[model samples]
Target: MASSLLIMQARLASSRLAQKALLPIYAGKPSLLYAMQGVYGVADAHVLACDVASFSSFEPIAQEAGFAIMAGDADDVLARFAHVAKEYKVDYVIRATADNLIVGQELVRLALDGAIDSDADYFCFEATAHGSGVEVIRRTVLLDAYANASSPFEREHVTPYIYGHPQRYKVIKPVVESRFFAPDLRSTLDTPEDYTRLVEFFTHRAFPSQTIIEEYIAWMRSNLYQMSL
Candidate 1:
């Protein structure tokens, strides 16, 4: 069985929503904490990858959330991922973003297990606007891409080199069957509008759980109906 690691890439320098990771989505917990908790048991190891300059700001937050921390190049995300994969000796890696608070653990497990069982170079859930999702990559493939990829976009986005070269890498995108397939719903926290919707959904409810995406969508639909009255 191949060992897998989950790396949540985060920084305080987002252009649209500065420090969005540190903002609270429920109660007083930071959004990073919620994101981390969402994938708590889905991987063998979970680490927060950030730039050295921002390590100080992310350390305490990561510590509080019980996540391992790694610091690397701010711009070269692919290099940072490869470095972490090598350092941890993990054969596979799951890439996650900190702003995605509603990432489903079930979907993450399905993607990772599918990648490992099928020996795929890359695997991802079909991108849906209903909620965030994760991607799985083989460590050796990622390292190769990092060593040879020249474009800044490929380096920054990570895994693009592998998936972009379909002839070279086997990629799998699993379809998730769920009634919560509303691709029109935006569940990721990217802008002030997104944050506002998140706050409204989580305000009086218990800290949003794994079913947050479904719950939020149901609530939005209900609210719309009430307004039509």
Candidate 2:
């Protein structure tokens, strides 16, 4: 079995929502904790990747969650990911973001399995209702992207180089079959409204990320129907 690593990239600094990861989501627990919890047992190892300046701020949180931390260039997120992937000797990597709290184990597993079964260089969900999703890529493919990708967009947003260059890499966007397929629903915490909605979500009794997502979808559909009526 090829070793896979799940890397959650996060930072305290944010132009839209500063320190959003530290925001209390469930009973005073930080949003990062919940994000970390969502992917437990889905990877051989898990690491929280952040910049050096923000390392101290995130170290305690990572420690609390039993996750390792890797600090790298603040703007070069792809470099950070590549470094971690190389250091861990991981054959595959599942990329995630901290503000995306709904990236549950199921989604991670789906991406990983799709990449392995299809022999794809990169794999991701086609249309996710939530901002939560996983990107699975081989370490060699990531290293190649890091080396040849010139655009800041490609470096900062990782995996774009691979997907953008279809001739060089085989990409797969797996369709996620679910009753709750609300692609319009925003699950990422990038704005005040997103934070407020997430707070409301966490206030309810805790459940797995998948269940929370399903419930949210159901609620959204019903609310839309009522509004139309």
Query: Taking the tens digit of each residue's C-alpha lDDT, what string does model 2 give over 1-229?
Result: 8779989999888888878988888788888888888787788999999999989888998987778999999888999998998888878989989988876777688789889999999998866765767899998899899999999998899878999998889988866776535576777888877888778766764645556567666655665622110
Q: What is the lDDT, from 0 to 100, of the residue 136 in candidate 1? A: 94
Q: What C-alpha lDDT values do all the predictions have?
A: 0.81, 0.82
Pairs of colliding residues, candidate 1: none
Worst 10-residue lDDT window for candidate 1 reads: 220-229
State the displacement of the C-alpha of residue 202, model 1, in Å, after optimal TM-score superposition. Answer: 2.1
Q: Which stretches of candidate 1 lie over 4 Å from their true place?
A: 224-229
Best candidate according to lDDT: 2
**Number of the top-ranking candidate, with TM-score as the measure:** 2
Compute the lDDT for candidate 2.
Answer: 0.82
Query: Which regions of candidate 2 are displaced past 4 Å?
Result: 207-210, 223-229
